[model samples]
Target chain A: MITAAVPERENYLNNAYGIKSWLLTRDHKRIGLLYLFTVTLFFFLGGAFATMIRIELLTPQGNFVSSETYNKLFTMHGVAMIFFFLIPAIPATLGNFFLPMMIGARDLAFPRINLLSWYLLVIGGLFSLFAMLAGGVDTGWTFYTPYSTTYSNSWVIATALGIFISGFSSILTGLNFIVTVHRMRAPGMTWMRMPLFVWSHYATALIQVLGTPVVAVTIILLFCERVFHIGIFDPTLGGDPVLFQHMFWFYSHPAVYIMILPAMGIVSELVSVFSRKPVFGYQFVAYASMAIAVLGFLVWGHHLFVSTQSVYAALVFSFLSYFVAIPSAIKVFNWTATLYKGSISFATPMLYAFGFIGLFTIGGLTGLFVAALGFDVHVTDTYFVVAHFHYIMVGGTIMAYLGGLHYWWPKITGRMYPEGWAKLSALIIFLGFNLTFFPQFILGYLGMPRRYHVYPDEFQVLHVLSTAGASVLAVGYLMPMIYFIWSLRYGKVASANPWGATGLEWQTPSPPPVHNFDVTPIVTHDAYDYSTVIGQEVEVG
Target chain B: MSEHIDSVKTYALVFAALIAATVGTTAVAFVDLGPFSVVVALLIAVCKMLLVALFFMHVRHSTRLTRLVVLGGLLWLLILIALTMGDILTRNWVGVPGR
Candidate 1:
């Protein structure tokens, strides 16, 4: 490890002491840290709800809780994970921390709005908590109609309003990233020369700005239904419930891309860094990110195959869904190619990267199965669908998140976590994750539906296995929480380029100063340009 | 920044036209145009949205990449709505045997 180049240690502990300063801080790094703390808190809350759900499913009866309570449990879990955690987890924390630094800027273009987004998250989060305390809505994350507006006993309006507010937070964040990427890059940091992480985020932000408003309107219409009895989604009043699904998934489906695109970007970086090579097929990988984001919008109807949609429509969506996979396959293959004939290291980030590839491929392929109308009819709400999404959202997104956290810990904290433990946790997470999710796929195919409090006796074996693996998964997740915090105080001082990485963030001091760079260094070479850095184009002031 | 940019006045006029079109569609909703009403409303909404997106969002003046990004969202939205309707419209003619 290289020694940190900070002129003098700025006591990170005393740097911003009061809650007010932290709340009011304009520093992008501080904002990122704030999100890190909040999102982590919500992660466990969501995880606890998930644990409750898995435990309830351990038996074939509604013994652990009533059906209503179980419904609330899963609904809250889905909302908390999607809205509060996954969507913002990586981009908000790591993206906020590093995007400005990587592009050689001091801060995001709109710092006050950056701070505002976090506050919006907290406020929206509180609204959700209040809604839960007031007897939570039992409508699933999709909030399918008739069930949501006409049937559910809980406060649908409050929860829908909370989500509507949070959608603005996402939109604002996307707008800021777009402006920053457009106007804030240092001289010579060309479009291709920027890190793949930024490129992926750029694509994600494009979707967020364009797609999020549609959902906001949809949710507001739902809220109006609850309050004013607006019959847009009310079938008896000549409104169509399927239209709501259309609008919701129109945003929520691409929202999945918003969730995974950044993770793909992270994997691209980690694979190249660990393998010590320029990413193979850089242009294809780059354009494929945009392709996925664009194609992601067209295929939302695939989710509606079993509903009132026509067979011809389902066939079209199935074809589009399969086509979307082509770009995803291209990305996966390029990553594999980048690893070919290269110096591959089993670093912690690289370990997580490999886990992402394996898990995401499984998740994506199964998505194909569900997207096909015939297969979806057999297992629409079954454990298979659950397993399919969990592989992508949890196994794929969360793994890349941990990988990015480890990759950038040195830069953020100026300290390195213990390598052995990091790798151990990565391995445990990989194993525990598969154990928890894989059985659900089989159980689903065996005709076990999800969201039911209990299942048949034969499925109990798998359910118990899933619960046991969840215990292990919890352990794997908690390990990093313990060690990463410990490392901040006592770990070795990290050098400017501990991983010998080539991003501009690495060229600066570890625990970068208030202003990221003392002088902006013009990036005259391609990203991951170890060869150019060593052989030809030098960093210029 | 440039004096030749008196076209700002023209762009403003275009913006007013969008507002008028939007209000016009909403107002004509009361006039019982039958199925044609929905089509007319949506067509006008599309025009206004496009004008704002292209001119006000600066897609027209922006680089090819930005135009591509803007076009991508629109084109796919059309595909989704169109293909969905394609299936719904054809369903009556095909008439599945079970029903």
Candidate 2:
């Protein structure tokens, strides 16, 4: 009988001795671990706020919390989740760790800047946590003006400050990834030879570098007008409030692409690997990621259909929004085509990939509905918009994030997560997620508005259904937290290349070395070259 | 990885051109070019922008990839400002009823 034989001693986890080593280390892998730890805490904090919001929505009346408190709950939830969690979720952690490794580099182009980006995120998170603890902001995560500036007396500046500082983290990370990809590839690992994960991340970094600062400038204008009377977004001082929407969504719209593009990249890797075939139309999948990033910048005006922007501009934006769906559709088609006539595996990662394709398709189709000027005018502020984004953000990105996490778990932790438990959790999360958000699409179509805790008697049943699903979703999320921790102590030790994957990352030992590859790799084939995995590259397992 | 150094003469020429463009912008602002006054000033500004980006910012010595990405960012910025300004300026274009 064959058994796993790779030694796990003296890895990056064991090379460092104390807390100071991790905090001060420039090793990309350790920094990835640090991002994983901090990002998970923010995830649960966001999740807890979401829990409270769902619980309150269970009944027709605002019985769980007061109206003001509900406002704070959703605002903090969106702020915690969007800026802190979703924007940096896949890229900062998984992409930070794996991107350098896959490209056959020891670290990002500037290792110090990589560490600085993590610290920036933490400090930014602190400002947000301070805002949450100090009475919470109520102007919505969008932070619309006059209300954010004048009327609603919540911690708008503090939350905006947190968001402001976090934008630098994004900008720096984008700059780092762009430079690293351009300069740091191993010999023969040309641009096309790099994995789709790196390709997607490259696109994500571009958005971060170019788009994030727009929102940063918007935020600076936000509080400047509030505190210094800059007359930018405030209407009482002759500012157009819709200008706030323009600058905010300029980044925020592409920001959604920032969240999902890397997830799509992960799904690309997962589909190719688990299907045991080279990705069908690999070049198209790679270019599709870039196309989505580019087209994503043009469609921010879809958010403004009912904001009373010019109808002509809205018409152009509405037309452009349909174009983004093309590149995203290319990705889904290729993933499906890759699976066709291939030796497929039912791994937990593949399960989430499947979940992502179906739900994202639903989300993308519904987006076309609202992209219409006529339809969006009716359902602009309703639960339909909320459901559409949740499908993409939650159903799409989070599913792909968890899938990537599980796919790379053995490489990151040197232990195999229990397959049975992981599969169950993925199933639970998928089912619970649909149960929760699917009804909201119907609720919004029936004209149920979002962000309001109280509603009429008729909407209670669907609310109860959603709340019930949220409970199950909570259980689904909690299982992975519990079992993943349990796996660290008692799980089977993972072998290098346990999945027989073909990326350069899998060429190294499980958990990898402090500098990733012991010697720099010289790539010889494409990213999905599974034939290379069968002999010399395959270690004992 | 070799650093590309520009000669002082090159730098001096670029600086003189920038100063000349600044004077041209000011001179254009004073002219009664009718509706084209804004257009003329903007044209001079664009020339200044190209000069600074190519010479002062080192894009002239940078890699082709760097030049492409820099162009992409500038084009995207133009999209944001121009499209947004277009949206705001055309509110009256759709023919409202009252006036």
Candidate 3:
């Protein structure tokens, strides 16, 4: 009997042990895991605030918590979710893990700086956590001026400082990615040969490096105004409150692309892999990411349409806002076309990708509605705007984040999670997410405002539905957490390429070795090359 | 990959010009050039920025990509300020009810 030899399973996981190795290691994979644990904690922390907010809104009355407490809860939720969790979610964790691997590099250009970025995030997270424990901030994540500058006594400075510190983490990570992509690609991994994930990240890093500083400056100015009684953002002084919005949105608007573009990159990979085809219009999809990033910067004025921003500026912004959607639409169309005449699988990741396409379409279309000057005047601060963003952020980004996580879980951990449970959870999340946020669109159309502790009684039914959906959404999010943890011990060991995908990462062993590859991989084919993958699958099986 | 190193003489000359520009800025601040003061001051500032970017930042001798990166940052900043000024400059136009 001929026996197949089993290779030794020494990898990043078994290469080191104990806390110090993890805490001080410059290995991007370990650093990615560090980020994973940190951001996961913050995700739940943010979710808790969201749960409280939803429960309180279950009725028209502010019974669950005081109005002041409610404000802090939402603010904390936004700050934790955006700054600590969403902003760093995919990029810090998956990007940190796979970028160097995918690009066939040993590590990011600046591995120590990558580690420092995580520390900065932790330090930043601690400041926000302290602010929360010390009574919390009422200024919403936007930290809009006048209220943030003059009124509302809360831990605004500490929270702002937390955000300020975290901004550097983003900047450092961006700089590392920029340099790595520029300098560290494998010998033959030319610009067009690189995966869409790298392209999207390159775009995201651009926004991160170029756009994040303005927000940091804005926050510093806000801190100055709040602390030293400066009038930079205060209307009572010589400064203009609108100026704060200008600077704030200058960064914040592009920040939305930062959150979604990576998700788009993930979807591009998942769609191609599960469909067993090269991405349709691959170059088009790649350039679309760059187009979205560049165009994203031009449309910040759309957010200021109702904020005493000039009609002329609003027109330009609204027009540009509509323009940005073209690239997004191009991506959506390309993904759908990739599915044409392809052997498609309804795997968990593909299901989430499908969910992303439908939900992101709704979210993107609603964004267009809000971009219109006439429609925006009515729904600017209403639940419509809230729903629109949730549809994009939660529906779009989180869906893709979870999808990417599930798709890469086998590779990341060298084990297969129970597939049935994963699929069920994906379904639950999709249904629950829609049930939760869809009603808010209707409520917003009915003139129901957001950030209010007490709403009119007419909106009670929608509030109850939303709260119920929140509970379901909570379960959906929790199920994967439990199963993913459980899989670590009981699941079957994953093979090198569980999905039969085509990428440098899949070419390496599951839970790849410390340096990722035993021999450096030289790419000879474009990304998503399924021709050889399909033929190889038959012989292997 | 190797960069061109600027000579000390060139550096000294650029430094001296920056100083002269700074003094010109201060002197112009004292005078009332009205609207042109801002224009003149911005022009001088732009010149100083160009000098630093081209020489100090090494864009003059760096790869085209590096030059593009610097240009990209400037272009984005211009977009932000210019579009914002469009709003601020035209808020009272047509006399909307809220205004």
Candidate 4:
């Protein structure tokens, strides 16, 4: 049957009532919902700031707002998007929702800490919100020293404190996922037997635990320098500002992996389930996530190529940066191979998966471009670098994030989203995303620096086109959000294992019980064991 | 999770040794072994970290996975410090583009 009964039985959602149930719930799934609601707000908040930036750039005269306002807009946009939205987007919401379920555990190892992690994120977000309301920070999200520590009179401390508090959220979430994955699997669910999604989350958790502390410490040192007259980053105070850059990028680079790895995990599940095949080189894809995490740390120096960092260090970083691409390439090749001659279905989720592969490849290749010491010299602080990261984060991660959201929405909500609207929005997002960022690559190549309110008239046409695309992209983003909400009440009910997919998650009822399963699943086959999955209605154990 | 548990005696001895190391680190500070001073201090710090991890944190009695994670954390910490210090120390070394 294509549909099943509306979830009449008590589930996680129906099992609770009132704001108190959500605000203080110990269920990982409930906390995940709490995160979903919160980060979605931050996403649009970031998007609104992005809208102002695009509108201001429409004619390239900086006429829409003052240069100072533009700086604040972009800074807050980035601060909201990166620290609050993207960093926690998939992990906090979807990962929190499904990680325990996918591994056949009752919940995360520490359910109370899971709820605490969500609270920390909210508290941290409030700090940033307070900063924004009181005339936003002007230093870019990178928060480079001297300008931030010595010169700027913006709300640097408030925003930095917000991020500092949020870093613990990341750290605790990672700690919870790691310990859970290590100890919580059901019988027969060994490491290799586990889903790639779990593997990717495991890798991301490692990065979050190990890398976030560095950034937190850097923020603390920044706070000390700014609030107290300490010289840690203030040049006049015998502190070296370049050291601040070193420490900040040290975590920020790995933080990039922290964003993409979970999304990559989502793609692994999408490609396998829709194609009706096991992942090609499952082990390679799993290890690639780890490779990216570890290698992500070694390459932060590449960001310093145009800085005061030594040429020798930059060269080593340049070389190591290319090495990180090998594992990424392996995953890309394996996914493409997974689709070869398989019964591939271009559902909404699969469509997004395809977009992820194509765009992520473009992003990863451009990464190699900037990895070159000479090439990065030309494009440093330019729109090319901006375009490159938007491709990775927006084009790549957001696409997979949407794909994962759609793939699991049935399971999460017990309702199937309107497939037609989902497909159209997927197409719109693809076209709109390309339209928005593609020209920036050209404009950057043509020598337009980022963070400038005004630019040469020669760059005006590309800027206009980019603005037009941003509007469309904004529309594309809004559609699923509207439809996803619409689906909750009006949409068709979802059957257990509606997609007929493998994994312990699909075995239980849609939206599952508060305890997750009627019985603990004993996994007897490797993940994506299609023989057991196809032509079979998955029954609750 | 580890089944093995340490007795109070083991904990007390480890605690005493930790105190001794703390005093030794300060005492060695006055010796000033030139280039080796920082290295000596760091070695003692490493020992102290290991002692805390093995005994107080119970890593020594924990599962292999737990010990590996502790070690990974230490390795990652080394990477952060080493790379940052490497860049700082090398900035003034004064070398050519390609030698």
Clash count of each predicted structure: 1, 0, 0, 0
**What does candidate 4's lDDT look like per residue over B1-99, in tens digits?**
327888999999999999999999999999969999989998999899889999999888887777788888889888987888878878877865686
If ranked by TM-score, best first, what sequence of candidates would result?
3, 4, 2, 1
Which tens-of-lDDT digit does each residue in A187-238 have in candidate 1? 9998988888998998888888888888888888887776778898889866
Best by DockQ: 3
lDDT of 3 by residue, B1-99 (tens): 996999999999999999999999999999998899999999999999999988888889999898888988998889878988988899888686665
Candidate lDDT (C-alpha), each: 0.87, 0.92, 0.93, 0.92
Per-residue lDDT over A362-444 for candidate 3, one digit per residue giving the tens place of the 0 to 100 score: 99999999999999999988999999999999999999999999988888999888889999999999999999999999999
What is the per-residue lDDT of model 2 for residues A359-437, given as tens digits with 9 covering 90 to 100? Answer: 9999999999999999998898899999999999999999999999998999999998899999999999999999999
The CAPRI-style docking tier of model 2 reads medium
What TM-score, to 2 decimals, does candidate 2 have? 0.93
Best by TM-score: 3
- Candidate 2 true-interface contact recovery: 0.68
* Candidate rank order under lDDT: 3, 4, 2, 1
What is candidate 3's TM-score against the reference?
Answer: 0.96
Write candidate 4's Cα lDDT for A114-167 as tens digits. Answer: 888988999999999999999999999999988998789899999999999999
Q: Write the residue-wise lDDT of candidate 1 on B6-69 in tens digits.
A: 2778798997998899789879998998889989988898898888887777766777777887
